[model samples]
Target: MAGVGLALRDGGDGGAPLFAAFAGAGAGLALAFSPTLTRAPATVRPEDAADASGLLATVTQLGRLIGVAAFGTLFLNRLESLGASGAYTSAEALLAGMDALALTAVAGAVSGLVRRRR
Candidate 1:
């Protein structure tokens, strides 16, 4: 999912971007069920389960928004900084920004794993 999203471009030969979109869609579908599935076994009462699932969905959406805003700000700052370099095209700046975004995702995944281990 992250891989496919990171691979997207403004335009190019072949249907690579289309393929990436499908991949992203697949990822989204997988993620969509996660909160409900996680709550299925974790919560005891049905009412509590419903509440927890709702809360989970809300938090997940909030997290998504925050991540987008933070990463977008970072990307724009990076692109602005690279603007002065004549050799760097907009496409190149976008790709660089995406690379940085991907790194942050990797960092988040790593931290999640570390936290789980404790």
Candidate 2:
């Protein structure tokens, strides 16, 4: 992740795309389970605590989704506008990493969800 940021700053050899995809996928998978994990009743049921925790988890998930979208968009836009030179373009590497994370996350989430259902 840190490498991605640096590469973006220094303009690497088109490695950012891979990083972004991984980041996006990770973000998606991590967030997708938010609701289910939140709503699940503990064997020992912590009552009010469990409910609060679930709410917190949901809120965090929302934030994660927002971040994922933002990063994904930034990466794609940067990639498309490779001809342009600016801070935005410089950010492409990090954004790419983030996108990759979120993309992976989404795929993992869908798979996990399906598996859980079965």
Number of the top candidate by TM-score? 1
lDDT per residue for candidate 2 within 1-118, as digits (tens), equals 4434544555556485657745754675566556556555444356677677767678878978987787677766766676365435545555566546546656766897798899
**Against the true structure, candidate 2 has what lDDT?**
0.62
RMSD (Cα, Å) for all candidates, in order, is 4.0, 10.5
Best by lDDT: 1
* Candidate 1 wrongly placed segments (more than 4 Å): 1-41, 111-118
Q: Residue 115 lDDT in model 2?
A: 88
Q: Candidate 2: TM-score?
A: 0.38
With a 3 Å backbone cut-off (N, CA, C), the pairs that clash in candidate 1 are none
lDDT of 2 at 3: 36
The local distance difference test score of each candidate is 0.64, 0.62
Worst 10 residues of 2 by lDDT: 1-10
